[model samples]
Target: MATEPAPISFARGAPSLDIIDTEGLRAAADRAFTTDPAGTFAYGTSVGYKPLRAWIAERHGVSENQVLVTNGSMQADAFLFETLVSAGDTVVVERPSYDRTLLSLKGRQADLRALELEEDGVNVRAFADLLAGGTDVRLAHLIPNFQNPAGYSLSGDKRRALVALAREYDVTIFEDDPYVELRFSGESQPTMLSLSTSGEVVYASSFSKTVCPGIRVGYLVGDEDLIAKIAKLATGTYISPNMVAQSIVNEFVRGGSFETSIATVKTALAERAARLADGLRAQIPDARFVDPEGGYFLWVEFPEGTDGDALFDAAAARGLAIVKGSDFLLDGAKNSIRIAYSGVTPDEIDEGVTRLAQAYASL
Candidate 1:
């Protein structure tokens, strides 16, 4: 029998499974059960495990009342969609956004607007124009830190201005920041919630990237009243988010494994990113992409006239996986691609980029 070539994947923004502390999580689960079996398995509060809630609250300088835990950040996103946005209400998002976010907004029947994303972040001038144009925008959804598929953080000035614009337009800025803690370089900027002088920001993050992905624990931080409303929705929807997972996450964080895991993951991702960048530079010099300071994705702009979909198909056909830039579009982002180094090994990144460069040249 002929051997199949291994698929070199640059398709998904997944943490490398090799470095995940599987044994640590297993031990944490055992500890949770040994300590409180009944509590571990019981139906719990919708707002999350109190200890976990307190931990997050204290870390972020917010009260436990400001936090509402969910199954994952995706669930938080859904709850916000259901609670805040009415049908036919306008929502603005980055031009090339996380595809799932666009899908979520569309599922809620939101009229979507796209703001052009620059290297520094969303075009503030354009967003200001939208606010002034009399469009009744209900939400401004953004992945401000190392935005997925774009790999750029908003400038500090723009972050403040964006919050100001949201207040002026009476729009809630939903900041999805799953990868904020993953930065390998650069100083952190103030979060949207922190910049909101007018109380118009909703913040969300998840442990899926930092911890094991199976631990479906994420939380939304916002106004206490809004969190209470969402907690009610969660209670009605699923009774509660996963108590068992929340307990396990609590143990993991309390044990101080979270920081250790983050350091390990960052080291690996940083190395992988460097290798990927070097490989691309050596093989395809014409390709352009902002070298991310930290994050899973590297946004690559291919040579002019390159067909993104065609390149996507070509790469897949050759036992490699890559995302077409068009897949991340509400409007369009042709002639580019998103390569994820977080999921693949450094060798896989090199191999994938080599194959991708070949595919590009062959076209």
Candidate 2:
């Protein structure tokens, strides 16, 4: 009997345990319990832990009324979708967006308009053209910074242009940017929420990437009324979010360990991204990809005729696990793939790319 070798996964978009600040989290948890055991353990308001919500509000320069903390960003996203997206409502999304996002929208039966994602981000010109065509789009979801699956950041010009289009079309923009803080290089851009004077942009972010995944703290910032509506929905869904986790996060942030944790992950991800890019180029010369400045993912496109399904199987057989590109799109991308470089070490990246190259050769 043949036993499969240990798999090197490029499928998970999570920080590896080595990069998680467990010690800091432990200390924060201790502090949270000691400082406010009653509040941390008790059932709280749907608006979430008060101090943490206030912190998030202050950080984003929004009032507490405009912020709604949730179990995670996904919950916040769901609440927004439920509040805004009726069945068959027209919604915009990036073509190769996070698979989970695509699935969620599909589950809601949304009429999704997917725009092609480029190195600089979603094609705003195309989006503008769509808006001009008079499709009453209800929502435009954007992963503006270090976009999931694509690993491309939206350009400043495009961000402004998109905001303008959203304002013109009277559409709400959902800025689902969980990876905003993970940038290891490049200057940060102004958030679309910050750019929109019309209050058309709703921003969502998570601490899962910067802190640790299990912390499960995430929030949404937007129009006060919209946030209030979502908070009501959240109350119906779950009594309130995990106060224990939020309390710990609040402690972690106040104690300044959160920034330290981010610095560590950023440095690690930078090296890992570089190694993956270099290894892919060296090992699989035919593989086409944009070297990402930051974030967990790198999108790769093989020559047009390559069968993505076959390549996926081949990679699995070679002890490498990768996500098929078709998973992210509504139609075809049979030769494309998404590689998450965040979960593996540099040595693992070298080995994984070599195996991936072999898989490609076999195909």
Candidate 3:
């Protein structure tokens, strides 16, 4: 009997264990305990650890009053959604967005209008048209840099246009950018929050992408009034975010381990992304995808009329796991899939893409 091949997963969008800085984290934890034992152990205010909050504000060029630390970016997202959205409210999102965002908005019973996500970013023209046509849009959520499923960065022109639209339409732009620091190449565009003078952008980001995900530290930066409202809601929900983890993260940054870790992760991800792209092009001539500049996910589309479910099942059978594009959209994208290369090695990426090719052939 022949042994089965080892499973190669391109599913989880997390750093591989080999890339995680365990030793550095341990040191940070020790420093955190020694430097701020009381703050780390106590149930502090809902604003999160003060030091981390201050650091985040300073880094983002915002006042400390505009920041709210949360358990993760997801919690920050939830707070923002609850504060901004009510049933029947209209929210605009990218067609192929992060699935969890769609699920959360759907749970709120908000009317979600998904725009076609292009190579540079969301269709600003379409969005402006929607606004002009009198669709009272409450919020526009975007993944700005290295977007979650598509791995496309919003171009500079699109970014400014989006901010301008938000200002003119009086709609909020939720710039959810956790992978901003993970860019493998090119200069990053200015965040919508930075571009907006009318307080039209609410920015959310997470340390989970650059640091280890287990830390569970994320934050939101926005208008002072808006952040205060969210913070009160956060108080009712969690009393306080995890202070121990925030303190550790603070120490990690203060000690310079954070930058080192980001560099290492970026180098690894760049190699893995390149390998996955090359492998797909070589092994599966029919596979079509835009190369990502710096993020974890790569979106691939097969010929039209292909069944996504059948492709998913086939990939599983071949020990290659991927996310179907249908999960991110309200409907359609039956020929698309998202491959997460962040959690896999370059060698694993090569093998996984080959297995994916086999699965596509089987389909």
Candidate 3, clashing residue pairs? none
Residue-level lDDT of model 2, residues 1-363, one tens digit each, is: 289778999999999999998999999999999999998999988999999999999988889999998998988888999999999999999988888889999999999999999899899989999989989999999999988888999999999999999898899999998998889998899999999997999999999998888888899999999988888888888989999999999999889998999999999999999999999989899989888888999999999999999999999988999999999998987999999999999999999999899999998
Tens-digit per-residue lDDT, 155-191, candidate 1: 8999989888888778899999999988998889989
lDDT of 3 at 157: 99
Candidate 3 per-residue lDDT over residues 336-356, each given as its tens digit: 999999999888888898888
Model 2, global lDDT: 0.92
In model 1, what lDDT does residue 360 have? 85
Cα deviation in Å at residue 261, candidate 3? 0.8
Q: Candidate 3: what lDDT?
A: 0.92
Give per-residue lDDT, candidate 1, residue 315.
85
**Looking at candidate 1, what is the lDDT of residue 352?**
92
**lDDT of all predictions:** 0.88, 0.92, 0.92
Q: What is the lDDT of residue 9 in candidate 1?
A: 83
Query: Could you tell me the C-alpha RMSD of candidate 3 in Å?
Result: 0.9
